[model samples]
Target: MKLQVAIDRVSLGYAVNLAEKLDSYVDIVEFGTSIVKDYGLIEIGHHRPAFKHAELLLDLKTFDEGPYEFEKGFDAQADILTVMGAAGADTLAGVHKVAQNRGGDLFIDLMETGTDKIAQISGFTDAIYGIHHSHDAVAGFDAVATVADFHEQFPNVKRISVAGGIDLPTAERLAKQGIAESVIVGSKIIKTADPVAAAKKFMEVIK
Candidate 1:
């Protein structure tokens, strides 16, 4: 399982610094929703905080204007862009198609979406279906259990990713459970004293 480090709620300079250190260790470097909304995508390119090894996944969490948001995101050099699962089927399909056509990855954040909605959008073969537990929600997450349930519920949706309070033991357990394609981490990895060391520990544990 791949680890994606999410950097959020920080200044551009601090984000860049953390990103630079984390670039080689993690599989994906995510500029969380706060970063994009705070600085705007256009400004990100101007700084050109390059990702040497890892792919850049921007957590746009887009709900509407699929094409417009995707276009701007791609222009800003985002390798993978996110869209909300709560969005209309037409909206998800539109962004999924756009993302496919561009040879980029689209992640459908299954945050607060009903099972019916998940069933509706679960047919996109190549698009990654993310089983997301909201950060705002009070309930703690069980990554392995949620992923197993998601896979059991939507067996046809092959590509799966998940996020929410992931830790070393949970990450390794998830990997051993053998479901998620990638695991996204935020504070557990990014909030440590040495993020690189923390990420390395996760990698070792998962391996």
Candidate 2:
């Protein structure tokens, strides 16, 4: 199990500082969509720490103009870029090709995509299919149960990841369930008083 720590809606300097501190603890450090859109690729890209220990997963959340966004993200040195599962198949293919060309992985975020849509996009073997809950949603999200159901619905998809409101205990449960390739955690870590400590604690759960 891999732990992905998200840095979102925070100042650039603070995000960099926190990321550097958390570098050794997490498997992947994710600059969530908010930061990417708020700070732009240049700012977010250059702030990347020299993480000899982890990969950088940038949630660009490319909904349209896939190629351009992926190019910018790759130019900023993102190890992985995300595309919305709700996007057109051609758009997904475009980003996937960009990712392949750049030697970065492509992640299709199944945030609002329906079951039929998921089945259609599940054929991308090199892409990660993310079962994500909405950050703007009012109700509680049960990521593990949702992921298990998604796995049952699309058994052929092997590279699965889950995100949205995940905590250390929840991460531990998800890891024990053994379905997701990686789990993404945001506010619980990024919003803490000591993000590095928070990252380490979450990493322990997955480990």
Candidate 3:
């Protein structure tokens, strides 16, 4: 299991500093949707977070104009970029090709996508299928159980990742379950008094 720390709702400089501090400890550092929206790709591209150890993921959430968006994201130094599963097949395919050509990874965000949609896109063997719950949803998420169910439904679709209010305990559970390739934690790691300590705690548990 790999720990992916998401930095959001803060100034880009602070996010970059936090990412640099946690780079050696975490596997991936994500600039969440808020940051991408608040700061356009052109600005983010110019000031890409310089992470030496951890991979950088920008939640571009490309719903349309897949190729253009992905091309810019890669140009902006994103190691992995996301596209919604609900996007058209052509859109997904276009971005997938861009990622492949750029030698980067594509993360398909399966937020609010049904089984039929998942089945349709499961053929993208190299893409990481992210089981994400909406941040605005009122319900709680059972990360392990959801992973197990997704695995059962699509056994051939490897490289699973999950994100939605994951705490240390839930991260440990997901690690033990051994289904998800990576678990994403946002506020639990970023909103704490000591973010590095909190991140280290999560890494220890997952390890």
Instruction: Compare candidates 2 and 3 on lDDT and give the better one.
Output: 3
Candidate 3 residue-wise lDDT, 5-63, digit = tens: 99999988898889989999999999998999999788888888777789999999999
Looking at model 3, residue 110 earns an lDDT score of 99
lDDT of each: 0.88, 0.88, 0.95
Worst 10 residues of 3 by lDDT: 43-52
Worst 10 residues of 1 by lDDT: 43-52
Each prediction's TM-score against the native?
0.97, 0.96, 0.98
After best superposition, candidate 2 residue 26: deviation in angstroms? 0.5
Q: For every model in order, what is the number of clashing pairs?
A: 0, 0, 0
Model 1 clash number: 0
Which candidate number maximizes TM-score? 3
Whose TM-score is higher: candidate 1's or candidate 3's?
3
Predicted candidate 2 versus true structure: per-residue lDDT over 1-207, tens digit per residue = 988888888887877777777787888888878888898899777777678778888888998999999999998888999999999988998999999999999999998899889888899998899988899888899888888888888888989999889988899999999999999988898888888888888877787
Find the candidate with the highest lDDT and give its number: 3
Worst 10 residues of 2 by lDDT: 43-52
TM value for model 2: 0.96
Candidate 1 segments whose C-alpha is farther than 4 A from its true place: none
